[model samples]
Target: MATIFTRIINREIPGHIIAEDDRFIAILDINPLVMGHTLVIPKEEVDYIFDLDEKTLGDLMLFAQKVGLAVEQAVPCLRIGISVIGLEVPHTHVHLIPMNSMGDINFSRPKMNPSGDELSAMAEKIRSFL
Candidate 1:
């Protein structure tokens, strides 16, 4: 079965995509920790981050860095925080969260439920910077 991220990449489901290239995609987290929380993932569906091949892993970070910089510019934050907690979904993903404080990246904190319009607007804002 295709993971949800793969489904998004294939256009099988809706995703508020910020950016993409031949190898990777950056999308808004539907349930975000902050307004610009984005997930950077390779198009290839590897279950674990560490399990990815050396080149793919390196490329993924570079891709994430680009997305992170855009997110930082698009959203108001002190800096973008990177997190790689892959347990929620099987596919390997890095979270690029806009942070104002230490608590901004706390996974245990309740997530913000932004409306579809809000997500779309945020996606557009981030894409503008990319």
Candidate 2:
């Protein structure tokens, strides 16, 4: 079965895409910790980030670097923080979250509720940075 991320990449599900290339995809997180929170995922459906092959792993990070730079350019943040906790979805992924402090990256903290329109606008803003 395709993971949700793969489904999103395949257009079986809706996603506010920030950027994409042959190896990876970037999209807005629906339940974001912050407004510009994005997920970077590999095209191959590897369940664990650590389990990815060396080449793919390196490629994923390089792809994420570009997305992170765009997130920084488009969003107001001290920096873009990356987290790779694979438990949320079986597919390996990285969370490129916009943060002003360490507290902004805490998953246990309450997530912000951004409207659909707000998400759409933010997605476009980030896309423009791409």
lDDT of each: 0.96, 0.93
Q: How much does candidate 2 score in TM-score?
A: 0.96
Q: Stretches of candidate 1 above 4 Å error?
A: none
| TM-score of every candidate | 0.98, 0.96
lDDT for position 49 in model 1: 96
- Choose the strongest candidate by TM-score: 1
Model 1 residue 24 lDDT?
99
lDDT of 2 at 76: 91
- Please provide, for model 1 over 1-130, each residue's C-alpha lDDT reduced to its tens digit, 9 standing for 90 to 100: 9999999999999999999999999999999999999999999999999999999999999999999999999998999999999998899999999999999999999999999999999999999998
lDDT tens digits by residue: candidate 2, 69-119: 999999999999999999989999999999999999999999888888999
Looking at candidate 2, the ten consecutive residues that score lowest on lDDT are 110-119
Worst window of 10 by summed lDDT in candidate 1: 63-72
